[model samples]
Target: MPRPIVLGVVGDSGAGKTTLTRGLIRVLGDEHVARLNADDYHRYDRRMRREMGITPLHPECNHLDILTQHLLHLRRGEPVLKPVYDHRDGTLRAPAYLRPARFLCVEGLLSFHTETLRSAHDVRVFLAPPEDLRRGWKVTRDCTRRQYTTDEVLRELDRREADAIAYIAPQRAYADLIVTFTASRTDDPSHLDADVLLRDSLEHPDLTPLLEVDHGGVALVRRGRDLLLRIPGDLTAAQVTGLEESVWDRMSFASHLRARRLGEFTVGTSLRRSNSLAIVQLIVLYHLVTARATVALGGDPVRSEWSAGVAPEPT
Candidate 1:
């Protein structure tokens, strides 16, 4: 069996981590992918945490040691009894049996919080959308799906802000890619622009050729230690189609993909396709596929060693 390529997607509460993870799973066949949520490792249930004055974002509130152990086991192609966290009511659920698949996609708040956990992934991604945008997303999601009132969501955000600043946001420095989505002039969330930080460590795909498209909305610029990939928000459907083609230009199996364009944005009862989401998923999917290829050629591509460091400020 080829070594499973583990991709870690880390971000704060409403940073679109699950949506991105699901999109990747859809693109890769689900049977070939195993999914995990880091939120499952919380040590205290919602009620307990509240009574103890601790937030889930804090390491003290989570079972990081167990999470680290599980990550190591998963990377070694071993099964684990992974814990479960029910977001709907913030309760701890029964553990689930997880068998390693061809690919592993783990998404949650603290996947990169420890060296042991970080060492288990072949790719690390951090989503850092603007604060306002993230706040809007959080409020909407909690109210609609998690059964919280808008005021309650706002209060929770206030409570988590300190922990987010101290713990969750710092993980961005360790990531190979940092993704941010911002509103366009019209302030439409669905049509938001994407600012992606492609760090120097990974072998990123070159999208330079596609920049010539009229109003391509894709630009690459060098700033200090990273390269930024900017996708404009106002691109037409045809323009987005062109960009999607460029993303898959190098893939020999593009035609056979289970879900080529499968990222969606949901607000209240409305669900619509999002070009920005699809592009982000595609870019990460490209890295996973390449890592798999490296393993096939027997080069030991998966990263099994990790070190701790302070994350640098966004450039």
Candidate 2:
């Protein structure tokens, strides 16, 4: 087996990092991968922040050395005890169990904040959304997770912008891929185009291998063109071949392959099939670990963290 690849995805808060990670986890399946979130490294709880009048967004407000230790353990293919962040309460809850897996993802605002953490990753991704878009996301995410009202979220965002520039903005230059959704123009874009770009980068192989497997006791909803021959468990060599065969038949353009593009075709996940109750207890591992359809507005692909401040301020 090939040595597992570690991908580090970083960005400012609410930059679609969670959404991208969740989508990939579903596509690749949990058994083959693991994710770590950097948010869990927050140095204080909401009460502590309030008492100290410190915002959680600042890099100085985190226990980064502990984060460094956990990541080093994962890279060595050993088990690790990771700190857990409570999204609802905005604090560290407890420790989490992290097992070794084939592919590991470390994601967060400051995953690449230091050179030591940067050296552990095989691939690096940075996502930065436009000020408005991030504000929009922050509003929605905070409301959902912490029951904060829109106005309150915006207030918090205003105060945090300086910290983002001083701390968060600089990390982008070190990333292999940088994805931003800041809309420069009035019209915004659906995120599908961005997903398409990211999917292209991963460049998954043609559906040949996935088409051969036999799906076990799949529900009626699981049948048809957009289905994958999901091997429910470990397979023997011959069983694996049979699995591949089934997947290929689905991927083949035998009038049944799902459409990938307008004219192009694909197999499986062509249509989103979300179960109301999600499959796993998704705890974003910190420490875990994009692209552009060029939204009509902010479509520039430049890695501008260094010059973001010095560049002429647009009116």
Candidate 1 minimal-lDDT segment of 10 residues? 302-311
TM accuracy, model 1? 0.93
Model 2, 1-315: lDDT tens digits are 333457777877777676656654554457868788888888888778877877777877888898889888876677788888887877678799998676677888887788788766755677766777777777777887787888878877877788888788887656544554433223423211121112122322244443344433221112222222122222334543443344335334322212211111111224332211111101011112111111113432233342222322211
RMSD of each candidate? 2.3, 14.4
C-alpha TM-scores of all predictions: 0.93, 0.61
Q: For every model in order, what is the number of clashing pairs?
A: 0, 31
Which 10-residue span in candidate 2 carries the lowest summed lDDT?
A: 275-284
- The best candidate by TM-score is 1
Residue 165's C-alpha lDDT in candidate 1? 98
Tens-place lDDT digits, model 1, residues 151-190: 9899989999999999998888789899998988877767
- The local distance difference test score of each candidate is 0.83, 0.54
